[model samples]
Target: MASHRRPTHSGLTHSARVTVLSAAAATAVAALGATPAGADPQTSPERARAAVDRLFQEAEKATERFNSASERATHLREELGQVQDGVARGQERINRLREALGSLAGAQYRSGGVDPTLSLLLSSDPDTFLAQAEMLNMVTERQHSALQDLQRAQRSIGQLRTEAARDLSDLERSRAAVARHKRTVERKLAQAQRLLNSLPSEERGAFDRASRSGRGVLPAVSGDAPASSRAAAAIRAARSAVGRPYVWGANGPSGFDCSGLVQWSYAQAGVGLPRTSQAQRYAGRQVPLSEARPGDLVTYRNDASHIGMYMGNGQVVHAPYPGASVRYDPVRMMPISAVTRV
Candidate 1:
């Protein structure tokens, strides 16, 4: 059986992790107050906008964690199903072995009720007695072998059951982690929304407009061609998704998050990609930003929480974040971490 080991976030319990994350989020929101005390009123709008942007970034990180946990849960569930199926088949085999052993015992019971040695001694013909003795010995050996087979089968099933139980536990933990990360993401987004709402109408409109800036317009990408046919196909798929809503955790024709868009686009190109940006960062050979071509994955931030498909000419098509549509942005949007050529 394959190992179903899951990565742990911390030694903390699920509830404890939730509490810690919530507290951290609250502290961040407090520090990045909607309006700091005695601050320059003129820069309040700028400060608020910055704070909201930070919150959105934090939420994206949480969303990636959520994706990781969710993916783990999916694999664990699959492994659990396989283990359970093995146990069931093992049980059926054991039943057949049991029936065979029972039949052997019944044959022995229906035979003459004297000890084998006594029967041999009481037999009138020595040759006939010897032949009967050999047959009885063979029956005993077969019974012993059947018993051993049953014992081994039982042991194997026991081990499989244990594995299934362990997988179930891991699955539960993954589910908890998924829920916790989801809550963290929600909290961060909510804080950002509240901050945005607190801004003056004009400032809020500006923020909204900036978020929508990528909609309905795509920068002309020139210079380097896609490194591969698959890359080119993925780029075309991503471009077709322009103006789609940025739905967190979605990887589809309609909506997508950062890594989701990457994975979905690659999938359209008949290639597979990992579920999270952090993992997707290593999906292929790493290259410097200078070598980036259309369809290369351009990851952002040291943790690789954000990713976009490079479209050459210093442009990329990405699902920015909530309230934004999939659109074109500069490849240097948030400090390029790594450019991966898939």
Candidate 2:
């Protein structure tokens, strides 16, 4: 944040909110993977402290992976630039050598130029003849050496040019891989930042208490989905707020993930619900697809991970992913398993 921000008792600063969020998200992910039940784990402050420490450990691991990816991208970019420069310089040297060789060959082949033997025979006196002959031989030797020098430079440049081109090709592939890795790291960091920002200062003590004991009492939303008018109004309102970014687990004016947005919409209609889709599925009355109506809880995917509200005409207003805008998409595209009218 650019405004007033302070460090927490855990030695975490608000400006590093992304790191904190990443830690919390990592905790949620691991729990989803290995936790047997979503039970209350908090018993004491000491225990909560231990839990937060564990969460922080998870955060560190995720951060390490992100940094590693970023470093790889930087390395690839640097290597590419170096190799490209080498290729260009080698090409320039090769052209210059070729040009010099062409001029020297033309001079050696010209009809106006005489052979060493002919030049010696054309001299007027014996002394002059011997001297001119020796000079002619030296000139011939010099021309031969110059042509050889040009050939050697051409050969050296050709070999270097080949190596440089190969290096450049390798660098291009590495750069593409690095770019993919960079996108992953940036997305993870941004998601973590969003979660930390969602958990404001007021919740810190409570979060700390929960973390000490490996428990967190996620605040429930306020509203009811079964109330038709209010629920319909809420859903319509949510639809109007489309085109916002899909920040995972977000519920809001700015953006939200699938479940978070649905939960928030119902909350506006006076329904109270948990934050996760798995919990959301169990919050409302189960209804068959044939009986499903607008403002009903619609869940998809095996883990009940994705949720959306049933809009009329068989569409859903939901957040899709990290880099997407929340909008209405076909409900049929989702892996729907059940429906609930809250």
What TM-score against the true fold does each predicted structure earn? 0.87, 0.39
- Note the residue pairs that clash in candidate 1: none
User: How do the residues 267-323 of candidate 2 rate in per-residue lDDT, one tens digit apiece?
Assistant: 777877766677788887898876777777778766565667777566666665544
Segments of candidate 2 deviating more than 4 angstroms: 1-31, 38-99, 112-128, 187-342
Evaluated with TM-score, which candidate comes out highest?
A: 1
What lDDT tens digits, residue by residue, belong to model 1 across residues 81-196? 99999999999999999999999877757876567678788899989998988998888898899999999999999999999999999999999999999999999888888766
Q: Whole-model lDDT, candidate 2? A: 0.57
Cα deviation of 30 in candidate 2 (Å)? 8.8
Report the alpha-carbon TM-score of model 1 versus the true structure: 0.87
RMSD of each candidate? 10.6, 19.8
